[model samples]
Target: TQLLEQSPQFLSIQEGENLTVYCNSSSVFSSLQWYRQEPGEGPVLLVTVVTGGEVKKLKRLTFQFGDARKDSSLHITAAQPGDTGLYLCAWEGYNKLIFGAGTRLAVHP
Candidate 1:
């Protein structure tokens, strides 16, 4: 089974604090996608890193794909209350998606 494992099932931090979430797997994926979701809303794609050793940044958020394509990481700098949400990682371009357990972040002001 191609299962993605995420660390820190839940995190609570003060605003302006930085945090990192990780997604690891034994199986290699062609591409990895990161999404953030709020209550009652569908997940919004944060970033998609396809190439190994690729790094992409969106403002304060940075995403990295492992060279082996078996892991990914998301780092948020100076997190705010607006950044509090569920972060999910998934393998894309497959008929079925393999999603990580998810990391719930709560940033308090």
Candidate 2:
């Protein structure tokens, strides 16, 4: 089984503060994906970095994959209350997907 380690299992920040979440693994995957899940809703795919050292931006959020392809990070330029949610990092495993325990983020005004 692939094991992914996520940092800062819980995060609380004020609006407009910049924050980052990280995921690391000893195994390498073809791609690294980031998702955000809210109460009662399924996780939504925010972005995927397919190549090593790749970076993708979604509005104020930036996603980056490590050069070695075994880690990834999500950075928010300015956290917002709307951004409060469970952030998860995932990788393909067989025909399914394996996700980290996830980082619970709460951005308050």
The C-alpha TM-scores of every prediction are 0.94, 0.96
lDDT of 1 by residue, 1-109 (tens): 4388998899999999999999999988889999999978988988889999999999999999999998999999999999989999988754866678899999999
Count of clashes in candidate 1 = 0
For this target, which candidate reaches the highest lDDT against the unseen true structure? 2
- Per-residue lDDT for 1-109 in model 2, tens only? 3398998899999999999999999988789889999978999999888999999999999999999999999999889899999999999768888899999999999
Q: Could you tell me how far off, in angstroms, the CA of residue 94 lies in candidate 2 after the best superposition?
A: 1.5
lDDT of 1 at 28: 85
State the TM-score for model 2: 0.96
Model 1 TM-score is 0.94
lDDT of 2 at 101: 92
